[model samples]
Target chain A: MDRLGTVAVVGVGLIGGSIGLALRARGLAAEVVGVGRDLASLQQARERGVIDRATTDLSRGVAEADVVVVCTPVGRIAEDVRHAAELAPRSALITDAGSTKRGIVEAVERSSPRAAEMYVAAHPLAGSERSGSAFARADLYQDRVCVLTPTARTASDRLRRAREFWAGLGCRIVEMGPAEHDEVVAYTSHLPHALAASLAAAVPADWHPLAAGAFRDGTRVAGADTELWTAIFRDNRGPLMNAVAKLQDRLSSLKYALMNDDEESIRRWWSDARARRLLFEAQQPPEA
Target chain B: MDRLGTVAVVGVGLIGGSIGLALRARGLAAEVVGVGRDLASLQQARERGVIDRATTDLSRGVAEADVVVVCTPVGRIAEDVRHAAELAPRSALITDAGSTKRGIVEAVERSSPRAAEMYVAAHPLAGSERSGSAFARADLYQDRVCVLTPTARTASDRLRRAREFWAGLGCRIVEMGPAEHDEVVAYTSHLPHALAASLAAAVPADWHPLAAGAFRDGTRVAGADTELWTAIFRDNRGPLMNAVAKLQDRLSSLKYALMNDDEESIRRWWSDARARRLLFEAQQPPEA
Candidate 1:
């Protein structure tokens, strides 16, 4: 892979800082710049060796970049990408790590035509419940699935560069349309988070002590940052709502089977579930 | 604590074999006899030192026991308890490890009055996706919550003996009425399992490769035994349905908030969920 001349990471949070760290650790970028609203976080990123330079101005920070990754909250991704597009050279490839893709892609196309042509919406399907630059790790994206959502406006060169950039960071690049990306992730990611939250809220306080590994594992994603998840839910409402409806239908069938004491139906439902889960486990990459 | 003199464990599967292993490993039982419909499992249990003796005849196996734990599948628990009560010594304390308590308790009370007096409905809130005697471990229940659901028909001495037996195996005994146990576990256990299955079924097959830790953890319980879970859901239909209703309401509110783009409401809902999950994690016993 060709080494990036200058790489800029906006937000300086867990994802942004980790990207900077990975870029620097792999020598993928000659200079890694951290950009965020929080001066303290930017300074910490620099001090932690996640970046070679720190800047509070997004436009100024990304002006000299060969590649710019907008890692802001889902709500702020569009504006930051537009800023990066306006400031950076036209040849500089722009991408994002937003959880949702359709909204961000649409906003970019509407607000910045030049950036729209250069921008490729991407979401790395990896994270921990822990947030902030302080918890950023260099190997966070290793062997993880990073979905690239490219619009019709996205240039082939820019798209190819974005894919190679993520691939260089040890990610398995999966190309998808923005709408398809949003819908697929709504079921695989957003729906599960919502279910976890609902499960966490529905259980009685008295039952907390008796909660074993099942409850703990089931509700683990409920511990995510509220503001970030709220933005994700709001930004990807259409697909997420559809996913929820599908999940509710599945749940309703199980409930109906239980209520009617339909042993065969219940058995089949569970057997299908068991089979699907086993298939998923078998297909997963060996644990790193 | 006085040693249990000849503990007979019925079914000799994961839970039963684990109980036998824990009893013998901790020197809590002088002799642990294994009873099962499968001769091979009983023989394996004996060879693995999970039990001192193996038998296919339930009556002959438990006739001289001081304690008889009926660890059959949830659907057959009532019948197994009645058989243990008829076959075991009159002085033996009879108990069961059924996931749901109300149905089992009511069935026992109605079928055999003698068993109702001696039987304590217990559920150890511990298990793995793996099943059978092959995966049995001595410390399966260590520091795990074991709910004892004793009805009015349950004698105080028998209940105490059941509590002591679980406590001796390093379990934390929690006493609750059968109905309360059903309701609490329906939300904490059964509802989560149903959601996992629903999530597993709703996702597209192509999304499996993109699944991260969140998806893996969320659907972990979907891999559990289909027959075993079907029995549990059928046995606890009322409470499990009520739990599903509660979870659906919670999910609906979240969906409504997202659909309306109600950022404030979404933030508040997620904040509450995060807080509740953190509180639950804080209260949990240190992971074994």
Candidate 2:
């Protein structure tokens, strides 16, 4: 396996720290630099062996890198990607781990031509409700899907490098049109988050004692980082609202069934849902 | 430490089988009789040590019992409880483990005078996505909350006996009005189920491969029994509808935030949900 000379991980949070750790652990990168706003957090990441070097200066941090992975919040990913592209060597590849891709891809296209050519929009579908460097693990990307949304203007060499980088970290890569990626993820990820938060908010304080495993499992994602998810929802608002509308339609049908005491309709609805879930579970790769 | 001479368990499914296993394992009952429509399932329950005896004859099953715990599907619970009440000794206590309470309590109240006096509606907040006797465990009720919804017409002696029975199975008992129990559980249990099912239903078939931990956790309850949940929705329609409305309101606010790109509103909604979930987690008893 060919190893990169240097890999700069901007933001150094859970996703970035995990990428740094995985690359270092796999001997895929000779030097892993942690870049962030907080010097203390970057230093902590270095101390934890998540990175080999730490720097609060974005330009200085990415200057010597062969690759730069922008791991900032969804709202900041485009700017971070553009900055990484401007600072890194001409041959260096730049990519991001933003949950939403269309905005980032379009914003990167509007950046300087050289920066646009270096950037690939990527979203690795791997994370927990917990966040930050402390919770990062080397195996976070193992057996998970990482979607790459490359525009027609994206350089082929850079896109290949982005795919190789994620593959090196054990992610199974899938390429999708940015708009399609946003729409699919809206149903699979964003809508679920919204529903979880809504369920959590609907629960009366006094009803907490009576909640069981079902309630706990259903609302687990409601505990995810607020700022990160808010940015995601805002960035992909159009597709997310469409997803919400579809879910509302499904819920309304069920509500109507219950209201009418339509046992057959309710049974069919739940049965179809169960069948779909079982199919989805069947499609999952075996646990590592 | 006092044990009932005999305990009759109606419907040898997960809850019923679990109750039988716990009663026998803890020596809370001298004899545990399994009763259901399927003779083979009853025999299987006996063979698996979930019961000491098996019977398809409801009358014969409850004839010698000191207590009868109705564990049939939500739709059948009322009738099963009434049948158990008619068959059991006049001194026998009757209770149920239906997820919804108001309908069961009302139906029992409309039953014969003896049945009404003997019945106490109970809903145990413990279960997994998996169902049936094969998954039943003796420790299912350990440290779990079992809500006893007793009406004004419920006899004091029977209520006391019902409390003792669940307590013996390691359940912490809480008494609530039947209507209150229905309303509370609608928010905590039924609404979550409906949302999980709807989310599962909304995901496109192609999106399943991209689904990760968040989707799995959000839709876990969509795998629940269809007929069982359908009956529950029908039984608790009013309160469940109210719960659905509250969830819709919360979701609509988030939708408005997303549509307007109001990051602050989105952040605050998710942050409040996170804070509430943290508080709920803090209040939970240590996992057994």
Candidate 3:
């Protein structure tokens, strides 16, 4: 892989800024150009050295980039891709860092028909409670899994190029159909967010003041960017809804057991879940 | 506070062993006596110097100590308190580290008629995912809230002595009634555990192999020690049940909003939760 080339990252927030920082640290890009509507954030990103140069003009940022990575909120991913596509020249390999795949794929396919062949849908399974370039670490993606959802119509060379790029950043690649990806994340990611938020909301509005550290830790996900989450839940409504229903069923079972004083059933339920979680914990690092 | 008295740690598990270690670290106790059935764990505690002595003979251990802290599983607290009452010297102060309070109070009132006057109920709002003496850390309770739930009948001098002992180990004290303590914990702790476990159980049994990091992070509490938790929930059943009901009701409301595609309701729920969590996260750390 070339050590130096122009790379443009759209939406210079946490994900975008992290990508630029990672690229710069690895010497993978000569000029890391950032594009975002917030001029103040762009300036902050520059002072923080997350990017070599940045601009509010999306077209100017993408026109000459060798690689264009869209790192916008889930809601704006497709729109960002469409705008970038109009400015990106031929041979520019584009990709995304969106959590969901199907919507981004559909949006890019419809709005950026010319750049469809160059775009690869990718999701890096990593983050922190803090956001923006200031918190970005070069090794954020180290040993983390990055799922790439590529359809049959996706260009083989573009897919190969995208895989090579993420691999260089030390991310293990998992390939799956977009629908399958959505379903898995619905259970693993989206449902957890909704569950945490609902648990937080369930605190009688009057009781929120009395909540302690455990409640705060358990509901940490409830504090995530609401606009981003709303877009995700809306875009992946089908799988997310299914995941929610399944979770509600399990909760209902536990509630019934507790209500009826079914000690044996409740213990068995907890025991089974504990065993599974122990196995899962053995495989991963302490979550950040 | 003279640091020359024998300290009896009743359970000799994570919290107890950690307390033993912390006691020794501060030179606050002349001897650390560990009481538990497991000889091997007692040996480990001795080897690690968490305790100066260890034994399975609860009667002898309790009789030898000037200050006896009940660190057993919540279900076992009453039994331990009763047994200790028979053997513990007249002047020894008895305290507990149970998550719930009302049940412990009831148990103590029922089982240890003689020691009720000396008993000081306390809940140290501190713990970790790891367990056993091997994982014990002397500083675990540092800068954490330690609530003392004393009944009107509790001896003020003994309560003051216990509070000073805890302060020596570096803890900020909060006082609450047993009933209020139980209710607060149900909302802050027990309810979250139930939700985390239920979420884990909701994953299709066949899908366990495919369950990934996000699911694992979401369900981390599901991996907690079941026996200890079972004891907690069983002993604290009334308030735990109340909290679960409130949580279930909250979950149902969110489910209804999702099912009806009520975007406005969902937004309000998410925003409210996000607001509260941000507030909690931004608050200063608890005084030790």
Candidate 4:
């Protein structure tokens, strides 16, 4: 395996820290430099051995790097990627692990077309409700799907390099159009988050103990960082709203069935869901 | 440690099987007889040591039993309790692990006043989505709350005995009125089930692989039994509907915020939810 020399990771939180950990552990990177605005957090990542070196200076961190991975919050990813593009070597291939991709890709193109070409918009579908360097694991991306959203202007060589980067971390690569990727993830990822938060918030504060396994499972993601998700919900507002509508329709049907005592309709809806659950569960790659 | 002599468990699935296992493991029961219409399932329960004896005839199973625990589905709990009450010894305390309580209590009282007096409706808030004796565990109820929905008609002695029965299985007993129990669980249990099912059913089948942790956690309860949940939804229809409306309101506010790109509102909503999540998570009892 050819080691990527001096790989720079921006915004060294869970995703960034995990990327550094995986790259360093797999001998995929000769030197992993962590770049972030927060010096204290960068120090923590360095101490934890998630990164070989840490710096608050973005330019200094990525100056001689062959690759840059922007693993910042969704709200900050485009700005961070643009910043990294300006500081890193012109030949450096920059990629991001943002949940939503369309906005970032569009913003990068609007700011600098050359930066957009060098940037590979990739969304590695491996995230946890838990965040930060403390929770980062070396195998976080193992056997997980990494989606590349490439448009007409995306550089083919950069896309290939991005695929290679994620592959090195044991991710299965899939290409999707930027808009389509957003729409698909709206249903699979964004919608579930909204529903979880809504369901958790709906439970009366005084009656929390009455909650059991179902409530816990449904609301586990509600414990996720609020600022990050607030930005995600706002950035993907259009598709997320559409997803919320679809969810509302489904819930309305179930409520209608219950109100009318339509047992047949209720059973039919659940049967469809059960079939899909079994199919999806089958498709899930076993954790490494 | 005085053993409860000849305990009869009707409709021995996960709940009944777990109760039997707990009692047997603790040496709390002299004999745990499983009574169900499915003789094959009962035999399986007996073979797995979840029960000491198996019988298809409910009357024969409960004839000489000192205590009868009716662990049937929500739709069948009332009928099973009445039948068990008719056959079990005069001193036998009949309790059920049905999710909904108001409907069952009312039905049992309507059918037979004495049966209602003997039947103390209890909802053991310790069920897993996985059903059947195969998933039964002796520690299923350890440190979990077992709610007793005792109405004015409920006999005090029988209620005390019901509390003792659940306590023997390592459950914390909480008393709530039958209607209140149904209402509370509608928010805590039934609503989450409905939301999970609805969220899962809304997802496109082709996009299943795109689903990850958030989607999986949000829809886990959709993996539950369709017919069983359908019955539960119907039984707690009114309160579940109310809970659904509250959920809609929560979601609608988020939608309104997202539509307007109101980051402040999104953060506000999520902060409130995060606070509640932290509080409830802190209150959760450690698993034994």
TM-score of each: 0.97, 0.98, 0.92, 0.98
lDDT assessment of candidate 2: 0.89
* Stretches of model 1 off by over 4 angstroms after superposition: none
DockQ of each: 0.82, 0.83, 0.46, 0.80
Model 2: per-residue Cα lDDT over A204-286, one tens digit each: 77889889888898888888998899889999999988888788888889888878988899899999999998888888777
Residues A1-288, model 3: lDDT tens digits:
666489999988777888888898898988999998988889889989899998999889998988899998887888888777778887888888888999788878877567688788999887665667777778888777889998867889889888988887778888898888888888877887887887777665544444545566567788777777777777787787788777767767776777777778778878988887776666565653
What lDDT tens digits, residue by residue, belong to model 2 across residues B141-229? 99999999988899999888888989999999998999998889898989989999899989977888788888999998899888788
Cα miss at A75, model 1 (Å)? 1.0
**Which parts of model 2 are misplaced by more than 4 Å?**
none
- List model 2's recovered fraction of native interface contacts, to 2 decimals: 0.81
Model 1 over residues A182-279: C-alpha lDDT tens digits? 88888899999999998998887778976777788999999999989989999889998999988888888988988899999999999998899999
Reported per model, the fraction of native interface contacts reproduced equals: 0.81, 0.81, 0.45, 0.79
Q: Candidate 4, residues A169-287: lDDT per residue as tens digits? A: 98989999888999999999999888888877888877887899999989888888988898888889999999998888888888888789898998898888877776677776674
* Docking class for candidate 2: high
Candidate 4 chain B: worst-modelled 10 consecutive residues by lDDT: B279-288
Candidate 1 lDDT, tens digit per residue, B167-239? 9988899999999888888888999899898888888778887677878899999999988998999988999
Give the i-RMS of model 1 in Å: 0.8
lDDT of 4 at A276: 74
Model 4 chain A scores worst on lDDT over the 10 consecutive residues at A279-288
Pairs that collide, model 3: none
